[model samples]
Target: MNQETKQIFSLRKFKTGTHSALLAKYGIVLATTAALMGAGAVSADEVTTPQTQPTTEVVAPATDQTSANVGTPAQEQSAVTSDIPTSVPADTTQDQAVTAVDNAQTTLKDNVSTAKDTGVVVKEGDTQEVVINNGNAAEKTSEVLTDLNQQDKAVKEATEKQAANQKAYEETSAEHERVVKEGQEHLEQSTAEVYQLIDQAKKTGLLVTETTTDQTPEYKDTKGLTGDELRTDMAENLELYQAAIKAGIALQDKSVADLKAALALYQANQKAYTQGNTALKDAKSSGVAELEGADGRQGQVIDLAKKNDVTIDVKHETVTPNYTDVKGLTGDALLKAINDNIALYTQAVVDSVAKQDGSTKDAQAKLDAYLKLLADYQAGKGTQSGIKWAENTTVEAGTAQRMTGNEPAVSWGNLRTAAADAIQSLDRNQNTDATFDHIFKINGSGTVIIKNTTNGDVTLKISNIQAWTAENTYLAVWGAKDGGIAWGVFATTHGTVTGGAGEGATGGNVGATGAILAMVKSYDYEVSTSNAVSTVTFNDIDNNQTVTLNGLDGAKLVKGRNVTQSGNSYSAGAGDVSQASGGVIDSNGIQFNLADAKTVTFSGSHFLPGYINTSIVAGIFGVASEVPKEPKKPNLEVQNVDVTVPEAPEAPKPISVAVQKATVTAPDAPEAPAPVEVSVHYYKMTTTPEEPTPTPTTPVQKAAVLPETGEAGSILSVIGGVLLSGLGIVGVRKRKED
Candidate 1:
């Protein structure tokens, strides 16, 4: 191991308890919160598709860990990718998984960077299939047919939409109902009277524009306008016009109300945005995350499904700052308390939440300051209304608003921002709910999903939430009316799962991660001695990347350098792997697939020649699906057209004649058997190859035939046969004479 790696690892050594707790925490937390994975081909985490999709299943009671019954890591790994990517290491699966942590810490920066910048993981899972040439074809086709038929059955799901339907509907319906109810009651009369007054008021030069008048909206009559009209009626009543004509009347009351509401929304947006900016800056300051020096925003994660591509959804979540109670406060103490709480609440989301938790010291400390400020104020430092600052202007712990010569005097804007943060997140129990904007400005915001699957296999859900175009990002989505979770999609990718390791939650007071994360405003910002402020966060550079780790011994971690196996194996550092060519392996020549490599072949040649006969073989290294040839027809056709048949005419029998070889030689060429030419060529027959019938073998009649003896026996037989035949001929002649 290199010296730098050893040093890094020594610094990263975890206490036994911390390591164990972290493992358990992550196992549990990750169970609740999985990576917001690419719906596309992702190796980060496999989609935990449920087996049997639910057939009136009995719910397994909640347990400390999920997937207990599903299988152990052994069973799961065996079923799929086998090993490498998903499971850290066989050793790492032990309690606390220290070795795995060491390995992960080394690769965290690369993994994170990949996820953020490229959304690509470094390690990918391997997917392969080998079709068996057995007799399951018909059965498989039948099963597919059966499944298709079953899909036509419509199942009415009545247990509510069951999941993502939890929140949007109720909120939306309530808002809609309010307008409907208002329309049925005081809509028309109010509309006509208001319009008349507005018109008359306009004639009297009381207002310059029609939009700012007491005009009624189109209802049914646009009943959707009832709520808005009611607010309008409340502000621009004819009574206000009459009051305006009076001697001491303030004629611009209606205008003032309109401006206030608009201003309120604007201020709320502006403050929240400013806090968001500050929180990010502070997070960078706190060393939680960095500017990344990335020039262009991706803005390209889009669904490739549309022409003009209507946006699916854009959402924002603002948190009402959470406050701890401080009973009383005054002067610098009260201001200090407010500022402290604001900083803490903001940091939680900005530093901790966004960066996957941790880093909320500023938020927690602020609450403590609030309590102190309250105590001091209740003891009577400031008046009931407010406290006056000491004329000395000497800066101390909590007295002066300004800290040092480096920091300028606190401006009204700063005071407003800090106060706004405090009030927005003010504790209602403390009768301090008036700071709505202040509390909400420092909380979480923004969520998005990228899915690339477009095979008509999409599942989507967007829950209850208000929509607004902020910073010019657009999203239009379909969602459940009252659901809390919004927007869902399905995507696909091409490669396998890669360098993905589950991460543990940041230590939050609540002790777990949320379904979504937002900016935190709870980190402190102090100018560092080097003129840098609050810069202390760990960033994973490889956004969604796969990491190849070495020395997962918990004894060491190495980065930006190669790893050694026994004698001579090696794996390049994160940057080196991509930059340098070829596969990565340890010194022992063990090339593990961390970056989702399909296969590795160092050097070889093709000597086998019994390959393709006609045309060229287009198949690449692996799957033959790449080769283009004729599609295979499994069962070949066989026909029986060669049936045997006996069909012809019978031949006539001729008189038989016996002739001796030497005794009777046909001197005249046997007279050619003479000119006896057959008039008709008797019968003709044809034969063809066919399965022949087997003849049975037997030991009957003492076995068989002797054709003739030898040369002497043949001579004897010839003479004897000739003599006997001649005698028989003489005897026949004698018999005929008698």
Candidate 2:
């Protein structure tokens, strides 16, 4: 120690400690108290627990005796040994304190003696180093704690921002997935439908390719394609609809054409069959069962040939016995009547033959000249036999001329004039003779006179008569027709003929007796005596009875009936023509069967009141003309289609996909946390010095190990502050010094 420092330290002990009372002898330790005061986290309210603590319990013995004298300063003084003092005394020399007194004082300063808050108090005996250092420690700890809290706040904000970003990312990602999924599903369904269309087109022969691949990529990606491409895609799906309509039209056309062809074919076959059937039913056959219509009249005779007992219409081979006419003096006999001697002429021959000669060759030649006449006779003759007599009578052969407007028979004068005119056309040979008396009386079958007129010859044969169908015609000058051997001597005589040519001669040449010659050359016929009663029924396919037509010319019809007319002819009514309707027999003398009013019924067609259908009219034409009608078209309903087919491919592709990353703002670096400002306020309930309690709660910063010049700047900054203060103080001091 320096000599003055030793003196100063000695005197500081006595002044700051009661030990200084005894340290009147020695006082060097007192200055060390200031160093102790600067030690740790001691504050104004801190209960400073000294690092070098002394035992306070031992001091309790002293304080208990002090409380016994409670209200006195002298009593508190007694609690401390007389060697200690309450405050430092300024005067006693520091080199004089007793050694034992300094020890006691030092012990009191290091340990807590009472529990009271004094806010920072430094006594001379206190450890200043320790107090100051403790305060510095507390301040440093507070700063460290503040830094930790600020970091924690920053971390919490960063965590919140990360969570929110995560939540948003999850929601956005989910929505994206949903939209993509639904769109994809729609595309897949559309593709399937298109595939069906493709298959249909292929099966219907519309597709170009015949493989399943035609259906692949059926759904059109319609992104950018247009115009023709769009139309093609639509067509692929609906071609079947178009095809159905086309097929319907084709079928209708074909049906109409086929029906037209069928109608034509049926008509041709009907006409050919009718002609063959008619020729079959009109041959004269004996004992033939005749079919009859309701009206009475013998049907046209037919020969039914039997093939295995089944009756069929006979052809030419199915003949029955019939009589036919034969000419006796048709050629040779007529010429002989002209070339013979006059004595040979006979009146009978003259009447019937017009003239006669006793020559056979000339008679035969004349008859042959009139071949047409023979044909007329043969047609109604049935069959001809040997001719016994022949004649060429010159009687009138014309219609009884009508008076017009349906008047009665022609006058007898006209008939006579016609007869005379025909007689003039005879041969003019002198050997022959002919007269009006040649007109033979007719009975039932042919022209015959029972008594002779000139030669007195009875029972004679006659020639054929001439008459036609007329209203008042002479009816062929005979009542009936017959062939075969008839009654009487041969009608070979004209009216009368004197002997001219040969007599009783039978030679190829002319007979000398002309009258005998004419007699021998004539067609043989007979007069009959049967009553010509009409018996009958006609072709009524319903009846199988014969209709015998006698000479019904005079038969009168019943009343209330009329005959209808058709074309150039007249048709019979269902009932007989009657006088009540101003008509007798039918104009053609046909009798109707009035019974049951014979009917011609029809099926679904209606005939006009007085008009008949063609089919019905033709039935009485004794013929049929059944042409077929047009064929009917088939009637059918349209049908719905059922089909399964693949679809066609799409026209153009259309799809787009894109992805981009989210550019999130860095979660705005957690904002700087707000600064901490801890305010320290001080208050007290009461303050008393009686128990001298010391407390320290709030800490202050001071002591820090000086860094190796890193904190020198801060130190220098503190020094500058101190320099500014020191300059002001120096200015005051210099002014005072001045």
Candidate 3:
């Protein structure tokens, strides 16, 4: 046989012998393709190829065939040549077959690599046998290879997408962590600031406690949180704190103002107290005292230099006695001596009137003057004249009826006794009598004669008597031994006497004598006076006064009885003496009857505003009530604030991208190859089949035609076409043998 024919025959023999083996071998490939199809790895249309016409050929006999074969080599060659299309060259067919086989192998390798890279596992399943008809086996195989490549691409894309998803998730998680950390730090810082403010407020004396109202800022715990939750918590807390601080500051300002007002009030009260004390001091020193009138008719005098804003000048006089005969005597002896003088004087006057004659004008004038003098003496008004006749009066001894009528004897025996008793009972330290007037001190000793001319009774008298007036004037009367009357009147005033008792004759009228005696019984002697006096004067000067009491030498003047006295010094009581006498008498003997004798008077003067007790002034304007306490300062204290940084969002789970095994569905097997005509030559044969003689024809060497720039699927198509042709040849040969 020729070389091409011999190759054909050899392929046919191989196909017949390994048909079952081929089915088994390709079963896995078919199953893999089905798996890819089930997984939607590739489209069916992408794996399918166009069908091609089948070529008819002779099948080669098995290796065990006998030599008694009928067909010769030449005839076999002719049959194969007839089955081939006349329009196509034999060499071109051989080239297509070679290229097809190369493509198939490349496609298979690519599929396997994709499966490994994408982690696609091929699971076991019922092995499907894909029988490819020779007519379009190459195209079908090309389509199958294309499907496999597409499957691989889909898996790669899925892997890439999954990686991208993982990357995005990681980035998001990192951002979340950073935000959480920053938020936590910010929250901590804010909390510290709040605490610092609170501490400062406390230092300023602010009272700060936890927030009790929503309007004030308060602490918030934010732990184990992140993202929106953390942000929201921090924002709310910050707002509260800010509001609280603002309110606190306002309160502090108000407190300061209140304290200032309180301080001012306190100062004002203190100033008022100081002024009041000054005014009180001036009132105490403004009073002045003065004495007037010699008889003690007006006692001590006191004047206020300032009395409701007016000033006054106090004036006074002093008197000196002409005869101080009663200056040293005290008690009963003084009263008696006074009474004896009155009696002697009365007798002399009566005798002088008796000697006067009633015929001449001269004699009558002298008698009238004598009678007027006697009358004045009895009334206590003739103190300046002695008991004697007036000037220009001359009388001769003559018988004249007595100018005075007969009168009874006048006596003050009770007065003399009572006066003596009062003097003896006078107390030195106490005022025994409320109306006690004055002490007339008596001293010198004297003697006098008393003669009664009316009855020719004469009596010798030695004067050693004491006298004083109590509440009235009194006259003394005495009776002579020879039945004659002796009487006299006592006078407070003093004068010199010029005539003697014997120079007068006894010829006076009894009426004159009787009138003189009757006048002594009607005298009233009640008077009111005090040792101390107070007078208030108004003035307009606000100054202190220096009170100088002038005449209080033997007596001591005490201020509100606030003084010390020793020995014979007298104590003068405080306040007005008219209400109650406070003067104490001593052994030195104060003369209350004489104005200038032992009295007190004010010497200096000044002005005073008003009278107010010193003690009360101090208490009224004392310190003001306690100042308003400073309001507690506003404090907003917050300790450490815990904040939770939310855990970084879990890295987004890597996106699951299923990259199934890149499988290709085998193209539906091409239609069965058309039947090839075969001519069988019969020959008588013995036991073995005869072998046909090989023909000496020239061999056609065809180059395989491969797609220059195409996927491996194209080559697989050509390879499948060649294999199917070989199978077709084998089937035709076997049918001819039957």
Q: What is the per-residue lDDT of model 2 for residues 432-548, given as tens digits with 9 covering 90 to 100?
A: 121233233222233333221111112322333211111111111211011111111111222332322211221123222322212221121222211111111111110011112
lDDT of each: 0.22, 0.23, 0.26
Report backbone clashes per prediction.
107, 149, 68
**Candidate 2 TM-score, true structure as reference:** 0.18
Which stretches of candidate 1 lie above 4 Å from their native place? 1-315, 324-328, 349-738
| Tens digit of per-residue lDDT, candidate 3, span 95-140 | 3433443343354345434434544332222222223343333323
Quote model 3's TM-score: 0.17
- Cα lDDT over the full model 2: 0.23
TM-score of each: 0.12, 0.18, 0.17
